[model samples]
Target: MDISDCKLLKVTMDFSKLNEWRTLPCPKCEIQLDIVLACGQSFRWTQLHPGIWCGVFAKKLWLLKQNEDEVMYQVFGGKTTDSTAELIDYLQLDVNLNDLYKKWAKDDSIFSKMVDNKFHGIRVLRQDPVENLFSFICSSNNNIERISSMVEELCVHYGEQIETFGEKTFYAFPTVKALASVGVEAKLRELKFGYRAGYISRTAEYINSQEEGEKWLYNLRMEPYDIAREKLQKLTGVGAKVADCVCLMSLDKPGAIPVDTHVQQIACRDYLPSLKDKKSLTPKCYDEIATHFRNLWGEYAGWAQAVLFAAELQRPKVKNLVCLPQGRKSTKMEEIAKVSEPKTKIKRKKIK
Candidate 1:
């Protein structure tokens, strides 16, 4: 349909140190696209088809300016435009440059460099809570490419489409009203949500009928960030790590730190030497391990943890987080493609 018929709302949020955070009219739906946890990677939404218009394709974001409260932003194309001038323009799309970065640069040191490296062209694009929850539920023991495929398949199968720019279709990350209102079992199978589909369905059914806010796990961004975190861990499929992720990205508890296996490995190796010799660890230990950094990195702790993990994974020594290769090490991308390879080969041979 016609997007011109709708009014758009834009809100800018500067997530302390992680990166730029903003939401604007989806070029398609004219609705707010809630992309959060501002960062450089957006494989969550764009992996299926490069440049594909689905009303949403998480783009790279940059900070135009940062005042005492907010940071203006723009999203750059990626590894290609890694310069200041280009990065600045990408963020100043509709704002003025008031030397905000320069002021922050006055205290130039390691932190400034960290901000320069991580903050420039970074954005936490908001996402639909239900979608983020489901997407993340599928995250445990999962890879990026697989996560992308699973989420996309869910949209294609169960989500409604928003007709936008040339073939642009967007799905509203199926709600309880949507999933419970429909055939969840078959939909889960179709999307390949895997074993957790039942748990996901259970969670949705429980929450959909309640007054549970989008911030239910986040406690409406009102409670002390820690308490909000406590509430998140109460959900199934959500351990200390998953809950922290939802809190950081959805609940605005920017301080929330998630410790998945990768982060756990890093913690024991670098920070938590005391926990090293001990065989059995508890959630309290994970919290203790993550909390130290949360304080160290300030509000950017979650982002820092993610960066540390991403950097470590690139080291070539780390194994897969969710799925490993049959005989060799595999990046998340390799693993996802591998999942469908045998089927693809049989189809190709049959056609030949």
Candidate 2:
């Protein structure tokens, strides 16, 4: 209930896309990440029958349509706190918005010029660096649903608690010490985390035990983001895409472009011979393609990729479009997907 350290602002922005944007279901489980995280506002966890400290005022980059202006609302931790203001003033989410508009204008890059001269919106919102690293590690070959599940499992079993969001409780993201406290291999598998368990535990151990963990990552920042990616490639279970995801989302490395399976497919479909064959197109071929994309989009490469990734993940399902009255729905209706999906039923909806 204490937010004395939080800042406040009243910038002109739109959130008309709040509901539509929140609809992006978790790719792995097909539930909504927003709903799982409680619309990015309530990251709660209940312990010992009482709600204790375990919530983070998180922010998400949203495509908000305000009147004629289609812009991003940095919704979450804001300049001020009844928890209402946009994150623009806080995270200082930045990139050349004008340049991004051009690139995202069409199937073409957001940088392309529009005939009407009205710019399409574009920008990047920074996230907590440490969380971003661990999150992407859960993301390898796995769907967003499974990734979110593993992350929640990681926290519930290890993270500390936050208390601001009432008895609505949540575990803190596990720290190096916290993560090292238990055997991740068994816990992760028991939670159905798939193969990522090994990577998660090994990475956590290295991060905690090494005297030079931060220094190692910090020094990578000095190199070009691609080179830094090469360094991370040496870690366990970190493939080209996973390393790039960490680079772009966590490190704020603009040149880092994560070529997820979706991106790989898009690349092959949109451009010529995008896929790398064994002899001619190796992993290096993929890197070169990512580099081409990074160079083409310039600085907002990471941000641009996020918007695209979100769009791709949202399979445009219209199977059940339940429009609730604008007034708040009771909290009980939310999908606690991350924590309970392993035991949850699978519901499929059609995209009308």
Candidate 3:
């Protein structure tokens, strides 16, 4: 089915009615609502009830619910004049995910197994660039729970309050200027942001200094993926992984793969078996792994990577693994040690 042909019409007679709901036919094969929302690509969404989620985007709060055949959405605080266009772009309904999956699965046996019936309906989101940037800055060396918490706090502290539902209040993601005015670093520290506090503040300040600000980030979409990633890395706390994430999720660079430790483990285990014996993933190995996926999956390589990453995340954690050498400790062990280490002093790196 061509998503361009998909149209969204109001279910009720009065299109301007307050709290009016609209249903858009979203086939399960094309877009899986649950996997798309909860798959770690985004952080602001909250599952308010079973099969229903509430999220804020573009300074508007929306409620989305999905069934086997369709997705129902309603805007609470603000009216969208072009609701259909917004929904289509936001969900990327125009791209046929099933076709991409079939094409990607042809060259890769490992990817074929990964993209089984269980992984269907997973699609990469096209998020706002500024929100994507700051959210990812909070993601360095962080888990999803903490990342979500930090982002929520940032919104609550600096963003405009959009609406209140039950005990939950929704706020828009803060503008760069608004965040910079709050002395973001100190405020974030007070909110328990740890080392990431400074990175968010400095990155925001840098963006604000530019005449285009948010537009500067948005315009990267027109550049080559490598060039865009290079420019993004100039921001504080943005490494290759974060830049690639921004490229893949927000900048329409579907070939950009963000290889963190989890993705590296998958590469070592499934794709590059020779790397299993290596102690750590060097820069070269990382690039090679990313390149291998790009070669295998073509333009939508990052989407395939996301599916594999989500599979790894959902897999049951085994406390005692049988595969590793008896004397060797896993990278996860090293991470635990680093986290448990006592903090004797606070050291801050000077941002150029």
Q: Candidate 2 overall Cα lDDT vs. reference?
A: 0.45
State the lDDT of candidate 1 residue by residue for 1-352, as single tens digits: 0001111111221122222233221121111112111122222322111111112322232322222333323333334443333422222222211232233334333334434332332223334445666677777776555665666666766665532222234444555556555568566865677677776776666666567634353344577777876665566676676667676665666567776666777778766788787565577877788787765665546645544554454322211122222453333222222111111100111100
Give the whole-model CA lDDT for all candidates, comma-separated: 0.45, 0.45, 0.73
Model 1 residue 40 distance off true place after TM-score fit, in angstroms: 9.6
Ranking by TM-score: 3, 2, 1
C-alpha displacement of 232 in model 3, angstroms?
0.6
**Worst 10 contiguous positions by lDDT, candidate 2:** 45-54
Query: Which regions in candidate 3 have their CA more than 4 angstroms from the true location?
Result: 1-20, 315-352
Which one wins by TM-score: 2 or 3?
3
| Per-residue C-alpha lDDT of model 2 across residues 1-352, encoded as one tens digit per residue | 1111111111221223223212111121112222222211122211111110112434222222111312122223223442222333222222334434444454354324222232123233344555666777776655433455566677668876542221223455766666555776788878887787787777777766667754565556567876888778776777777677667655657667766555665555554363634234358767766876766655656655555544444422212122333563434222221221122122332211
lDDT, candidate 3, 1-352, per-residue tens: 0001111111111212225346666678877766677666778775544454668886787777766766667777755566656767788777778778777777787888866787787888999988898899988766666677778888999898987764457788888888767577887888899989989988888888898876788899999998999999999999888899899999999899998888989999898998888787687888999999998888888988888886776622212112323454445322222112122221222211
lDDT for 183 in candidate 1 is 66
- State the local distance difference test value for candidate 3: 0.73
Which of candidates 2 and 3 reaches a greater lDDT?
A: 3
lDDT of model 2, residue 108: 56
Best by lDDT: 3
